[model samples]
Target: GVTAITAVSPAISARQEDTAVAVANVVMFGTLAMLAYPYLAHHILAADSHRIGMFLGLAVHDTSQAIGSALTYSNVYSDEVVLKVAAITKLSRNLCLAAVVPWLTYLNVRAETKDDEGKEEELEGKKSAGGKSVLAYVPPFVAGVCAMAVL
Candidate 1:
């Protein structure tokens, strides 16, 4: 999702909304899976062990949510490690989304600047060609990078 959004450059906000929709869809699916899987597993897989049900819930339901849920249930559940790791992994993925959106913004802004310069040059060819090459776009390419590093 992060990769997809970042690649879309200039459409950061729209892409983010798209990502939210996708995540919402996945969350809904996970919710349904959590409810359905336990019943199926209880009847067919392990009638004696409730642990299996819990594990399946974490694996299939809201996997990321389950990890967070597991932290509080560590004393009650023996296999908390797996659930914790999975939750952290999901969080890591979400963190990537933060980066993706900003990068797309940068790209979009840069592209816009480039386009604007091109248009101005087109309309004022006689004036610009004889005077100087524009440095209007340089601030973003060079100064922006420098400022970004300082930040």
Candidate 2:
């Protein structure tokens, strides 16, 4: 998710430093989540397979870490259901990335448009005097993702 955000950062006019900070934060927290979530599910929550899976899926930031935690939990507890549920839940969350990036870009463009006070100027391709389409604001990778989804 952070990687996708960083890829679209240029289209959204995000600062490099901000993207760097975001990557750093995700790496730090994602590692911690990977290490901590299994223990939390097994010991702290004392939850069943379904609940443990849901907890890990929702709590962890990255898909790999979430699945890893689930695998760890399942291996320790000898429950395959936990791994399955966690994979499904985490994948469902991952799908949200397709919508989130464009929505954030739209919001950023809208704010910039408001700041421009109706001036006919380009702001990150959201608007342009050259009459560029709204697609101008979409990052190429996002279009590729949509294409892959269609396929």
The global C-alpha lDDT for each of the candidates, from Candidate 1 onward, is 0.45, 0.75
Evaluated with lDDT, which candidate comes out highest? 2
Please provide, for model 2 over 87-120, each residue's C-alpha lDDT reduced to its tens digit, 9 standing for 90 to 100.
9898777666668777776666665555346653
Q: Candidate 2: lDDT of 78?
A: 90
Worst 10 residues of 2 by lDDT: 125-134
Question: What is candidate 1's lDDT per residue for 37-146, written digit by digit as tens?
Answer: 54554456454344543455345534444544444344444545534554555544444444554455544444444454465234253223334323321223334434
Query: What local lDDT does model 2 show for residue 23?
Result: 81
Error of 1 at 72 (Å): 11
Runs of candidate 2 with Cα error greater than 4 angstroms are: 115-151
Candidate 1, superposed: residue stretches over 4 Å from native: 1-11, 15-24, 33-77, 111-151
lDDT of 2 at 76: 82
Q: What residue pairs clash in candidate 2, if any at all?
A: none
